[model samples]
Target chain A: MKNSLLSIYNIAKKDLLIELRNKDVILSISGFGTIIIFIFSFAFDVGSSLSSSTAAGILWSSISFASITGINRSFMLESENDTLEALIMAPISRDIIYLGKVVGNFIFITISEMVILPIFAILFNFSILSLEFITCCLLANIGFSVVGTLFASLSIKVRAREVLLPMLFLPCIIPILFSSIEATSMIFQGKGWNDLSIWFQLTVAFNLIFLIFSLFISNVIYED
Target chain B: MSNIIKNKLLTCSAIFMFINLYLIFIWVPTEANQGAIQRILYIHVPVSQISMLAIILVAVSSVLFLWKRNQFWDKIAISAAEIGLLYGTIMLLSGILWAKPVWGVWWTGEAKLTTALILYLIYVSYIMFRNYFPTGSQGQRIAAIIAIIGALDTPLIYFAANLWSEAHPPIVLGPASENDSSFSSNDMRIVWLFSTITFMIFFVYLLRIRYKLQDTISKYLTNT
Candidate 1:
């Protein structure tokens, strides 16, 4: 068990280190996220003062799109370098590799969110700096990373992976997106913590379920 | 498994479906509230039920494929998914037909319809994933992983959709809403039950044919 944990940590660290060296994934994700937010703000004319729910919808949608771009790039990086095959060939189990990628993706997406959220708040004229909002974002990111990593690996070999990744990932994470959007909107609306509790629980449940299932199936998917 | 049995089953299902169409269009009393359009329920409800069933079958077969490493299970998974996609499309169209007159809009973000649409998209992506991979164990493995992950997410999707719908004022547009208690009547129940059975048989017949087609294609590919 300790060995497995160590392996997972090492793999995750390796991926993170590579990402740090290149910085392409982070730059692309943040750029794409900002562009999406800009378009949505202009399209919705947020300067006229948007409803909290509309703002929440726009914010989450941008994050969702950026996450897809991030996920695709992350796997594409591995595939381009043939590192994915090397990882599979190593003594480490596929589940450990999956866990590593999940961790790596979670970190990347969280960092991108950190950058995106401040811009979103400034542009949309909403205060999203609260603990509840951050917690919801974290929980949603975990669900996204777990499911996104699995789908990213699956789509890595496909010719049209650019199109396939979002197609495969979005529907699977609808519940996470919905709950996060709901909770975030509630926070923006100044609703009480009790109102956000159910969405929080739903997000947690979504994260746990997908995390476990992804772990279970990752080996099967990677064992080409 | 024999050709004779396949033909018999196909003929029986065809006849059963004809009987169901007659009962739906002619025998069943028209719903007073929705008039003739409500008859679409006979097709919509049964097809939706089968679509759900088909997805569940895909998930089950996917798990079994991963566990046993059997090509047969993979065949079953793909076949069910294909058939499910077909029926799900029918469900969506019939739903639109019913919704236009009843809901006064062709589409709404109502939970059930949204969930069905997402589910259909998921299946479409699943088929695309299967096709993108070259004919090999690798493709099958990836598709199985997708099927398993999708199945796990299904309940979460339902929960989130229900929560979203509840938070907003209920849309009284769909046939499954509280106001449509027509199924509470004995005749409606009987007819619905018969239609459901007929559809189930139809699902089985289609699945067998699809499975055979996949098997033959795979065989031909290998021979070539």
Candidate 2:
């Protein structure tokens, strides 16, 4: 287990090093997240009758949509550079590769969320810095990252991946989307732990199930 | 051997289906509240159950295919996903038509409805992924991963969607619904039980035929 953790850390570090060099995925995800917020404001007609729930909804929805680009780019870079096979052929068990990717994605999305939340706060006019809201974001980000990584790896070879990833990922992640949004909305509405616990537990369950399940199938996911 | 089994199953389901139609139309009393619109319940509910069952069937078959490295389970997974989409379309259409006069709209983001819609989209994405990914063992492996994740996500989807809406239909056709169903008349209950069983058999019949067709196509592709 120690060796495995080290290998996972190493793989994740590799991803982080590459990302730091270019910052393409992080920049695009944050930019897309901001654009999503703006578009939703138009749809909801900003400043007329917006509620805290609406603010919470905007925040989570942007995160979910923006993270898709990050996911696609993560794998796309490897496949596009012809490095997926080299990584898969490395001296490591397949699950480590899968876990590493999941860890990398989870961090990338969290960083994007940091950039997004403050911008969302200013536009949607919410305090948006409570401990409960931050807790909800972390849980939701983990859920999003795990499922996104699995499908991104699965669809890496598909020709229409740009269109197909969201089509595939959105449906699988709907529960996460719902759970996090509900949790965030309740936090915005001044609901306490009693109400937030249910959504948080659901989000945690979703994350763990996908995390274990995707690991079980990750060997198949990366195989030739 | 396969031909004989499929023929027998098809004949049995057809006879059972005719009897089911008779029972549903002539025997069961029309619900007073929704009137004729509620008759869609007979068609909608059974197909809805089958569509839900298909996700589990596909997921199990997918797991088996990945573990055993066999084409038989792959065939089952493919056929089940395609058949699930067929029933899903019927379920969605019937639900929408029924909802028009009853719910006063064609669609609502209600818990069950949202879950069903998302499940249908997930299956559709699976089919799309299978087609877009190159035809090979790797394709089947990735598809299995998709099925497993989708099945695991099912209950959470309902939970999250439930948080958004409370208006719902009563349970029918099971022990749990014995006292829960609003339409608990003996005739409705009896017909619903029979209809559900018949539709399940029909689902099996279609599954077998589709599996055979997929087998032949794969064999032919491999031969050429």
CAPRI quality level assigned to candidate 2 from its DockQ score? medium
Instruction: Name the best candidate (by DockQ).
Output: 1
Residue-level lDDT of model 2, residues A16-85, one tens digit each, is: 9999999988988999999999898888877775776667777777888899988999898999898889
lDDT of 1 by residue, B41-120 (tens): 88899999999989999999988998898989999999999999999999999998888887667877787887888889
Please write out the lDDT profile of model 1 over residues A1-224, one tens digit for every residue: 99998998998898789888999778878889999999998898866888888888889989999998998999988889888889999998889999988888989999998899999999989998788888888998898888888788888888788888899888888998889888988999888788999999998888888778777767676875
DockQ of each model against the real complex? 0.80, 0.74
lDDT for position A24 in model 1? 76
Best by lDDT: 1
Estimated TM-score per prediction?
A: 0.94, 0.91
